[model samples]
Target: MIPEQRRDFIYRYVHEKNVASFNELAELMNVSHMTVRRDILALEEEGKVVLINGGIKLNNLLKLELPWREKAELNHDVKRKMGELAAMLIEPGQTIYLDAGTSIFEVAKAVAASNCFNLTVVTNDFSISHYLMDMPHITLYHTGGLVEKRNRSCLGKSAANFLSTINIDVAFISSSSWDLERGMSTPDEGKASVKEMVLQVSKRRVLVSDSSKFGKYAMFHICALSQLTDIICDTALPDDACQTLAAQNLKLHLVSTEREQNHA
Candidate 1:
């Protein structure tokens, strides 16, 4: 398997099992113990896993947030497809709020690439602001606040104050984890505050996430799933998840990828 896929498989396995021995991982992955150690080291470096005595475990700390670059790489294709689907909801001359997240970054990219112009975009993410700098027709507003380096996003009181002032037509929000029980959550309190404010101010709130995010919980809770106007996810999302969202009367937009289409 490719390195990314291998790493993701390891992550999912460890996450599901909560803990795994070196021998077990090596056997499950069909690789040597050395290869398992190497993959475990990579995941350790990413803060997603912790190496214990002869075993590995998911970080499991509710407040541990992975680095933005690391997460951006985890589900790259799924995120891009979700981004494209999210951009379809945007119209011309609208005021938009883009939350600070790697998944939301894809949405910003799709918006930047589209024919939609003369739009005012407000964001707490420095990278997203920088990405739209060359797009002449877009008016970009940055939420000046404390930076959370791991996520490369702005947060704290200054960001919240700025967000409260603006009226957003559509807000694209992302979270580290979500489920029927926890709703939406993030590790950072400041980021959660900013996201909650954006949801309140926007006329429509759309959540952009991949299937991997399901059945997880974070430290800070934002809002329940029913609050969102819509959610964009790939076809890899489980049927039970779809059923849960549907039961809540929430709109879940399923975007099919080429591989999923072929299988169908």
Candidate 2:
């Protein structure tokens, strides 16, 4: 398997099994103990685990990771609000750049509801593209690239080249992790390149992330925290985080996390 695919498999296995030892992984992937150790070391460097005596344990204090689908489910209410707020920023007869992440896809769903006339939506995410295909009122543009099955997204050189050619009114993106030090990040270099493209095309940029993203850093850097135009997060965040973002000269929006049923 390719290195990226191998790493992704290791991540999926570790997160699913709560692995206790390198031996377990070695047996599961049909690899040797030393190979398993190398995989664990790689994951550990990305802040995914803590090695211990002859074993490994996921650090409870470390960032939480969910499957692509499960992540979309976790903060549905907040994401919807974030999506609405992102869409509200849209102007008719303008073009936007959409990065492929759950939060950004939520923004597309919200935008689809609005069906803003004469607005162009450009993206590399298959799920978001399919979502907008039926919405005739909004013009949709897609980039060609190899598809990622889990997230149903596209990436690589072609997509990057496509993004380079278009200037956009706004770009709404999601993050794997965020911290003042490393800024916004992702585990995959391929996706990070796509994000770089989003930044390149956007005249104005917005980052749509949740509370879970704050105080964390991921593998690949897309851009520095100061580069963000605004950050939209849920109200459940701490004051210190809000202060930190403001200190970076970033506008912040706090959306309600509670579902409508609970609000009622």
Which is the leading candidate under TM-score? Answer: 1
Model 2 misplaced regions, further than 4 Å: 1-66, 259-264
- lDDT score of residue 204 within candidate 1: 94
lDDT of 2 by residue, 172-228 (tens): 888857777778877777888988888877888999988766666656778997887
Worst 10 residues of 2 by lDDT: 58-67
Off by over 4 Å in 1: 1-61, 257-264
User: Model 1 — which ten-residue stretch has the worst lDDT?
Assistant: 60-69
TM-score of each: 0.81, 0.75
Candidate 2 TM-score to native? 0.75
lDDT of 1 by residue, 27-144 (tens): 8778898888888899898778888999897775444655777677666777888989899999999999998888889999999999998899999998899999889989999998
> What's the count of clashing pairs in each model shown?
0, 0
